[model samples]
Target: MPSLSQFSRCLFFILLSMIVTQCADKSVEENLADGIKFTEDRQYLRALDAFQQAVAKEPGNPKAHYSLGGIYNLMNRLPEAEQEFKIALKIDPTYVDAIYSLGFTYELMGDKEKAQPYYDKYNKLKQKWNEVLQKESETR
Candidate 1:
């Protein structure tokens, strides 16, 4: 059997390791919230880091990709923004904001032809969403 002092030290180390692991491992939603807060503060680099962490934690999350793309767009990193938005759309084809942002990013890149189809898709989706809202309101 272990001595009392050795057992206490071992338990203390185990608890410390658990706390450190939990601190190091932020949830995807926590990272996303941090990114949003950083963006609101105009801390672009910190926002980028937070968004990247969110993406890493949940690569299939369209919201994470969309939020990352929005930061890139605000920073005028149009090509990267376009790529992230495309990834988001790949994960969720009906992601309206990503569709609109991708089109806007293309326009910013001076590629009007490329932008048009995305813009058209966004408009169609928006129209459908509005119709759904209208029907819901009518039922209520």
Candidate 2:
């Protein structure tokens, strides 16, 4: 019951929305890889962008937020790093890296006392993480 011009406009809007959504559907893995690659290359800003995209894609992915926090920490954006690390921990309580980063963030914030518990947890986890890595390396 619509006019030709009206129908064309509706179709155009629908097509545009579909195209935008498809473009936005990129996998979180792709974004994470891009982020890591950029981080390795020392392109911190680009890495941050990629990690942000990954977080956008997988809002529940603690690792994505942790990676972003790591990048920010490296860049000396302590507050931003702290925020992202906190968010990552909120999403995943047992995330060792986030806990470690938060300890560092507390240090940066001049709250050594707040950092203590996190530091203890990180040290415990780091030992285990290192052992796992060593075993994996021996296997390789």
Candidate 3:
């Protein structure tokens, strides 16, 4: 037999699971788009909600992680932003934008040592991407 607190905890988890399941019903892209729109509208809380849903729906999606990180960064949630950006890099190591943003997050948090490697990676990737674009344009 469960005690009152035990039962309450169980009930809470059940409700939370149900909510998460319902949120997962939406596609990751839909959530990401909603997050972007909400951010553009300056609705930070709504944007956070959408990005969180995107992350829950697609845990391995780098874009979802990046979007979530961006929202956290905008809201001055530095630790959460760092975590999400790191997750994005874990999912896609060559995610130059996330690398750049992670560096920026660290800089904002006053950790220049931690920011250096990410900034270096971002700069390298940006240069390579630019070269590719330039070559493509030359061929066109």
Tell me the whole-model lDDT of each prediction, alpha carbons only: 0.96, 0.91, 0.94
Off by over 4 Å in 1: 1-23
Query: Whole-model lDDT, candidate 3?
Result: 0.94
Runs of candidate 2 with Cα error greater than 4 angstroms are 1-25, 125-140
TM-score of each: 0.83, 0.70, 0.79
Would you list the rank order by lDDT, best first?
A: 1, 3, 2
State, as a TM-score between 0 and 1, how close model 3 is to the true structure. 0.79
- For candidate 1, the 10 contiguous residues with the lowest summed lDDT are 20-29
How displaced is residue 71 in candidate 2, in Å?
A: 1.1
- lDDT string, candidate 2, 32-91, tens digits: 888899999999888998899998878899999999898998888999999999999999
Best candidate, lDDT-wise? 1
lDDT at residue 40 of model 1 (Cα atoms): 98
Which of candidates 1 and 2 reaches a greater TM-score? 1
Q: How many clashes in each structure?
A: 0, 0, 0
Point out the higher-scoring one by lDDT: 1 or 2. 1
Per-residue lDDT of candidate 3, residues 53-122 (tens digit) = 8888789999999999999999999999999999999999999999999999999999999999888989
Candidate 2 yields a Cα-based lDDT of 0.91
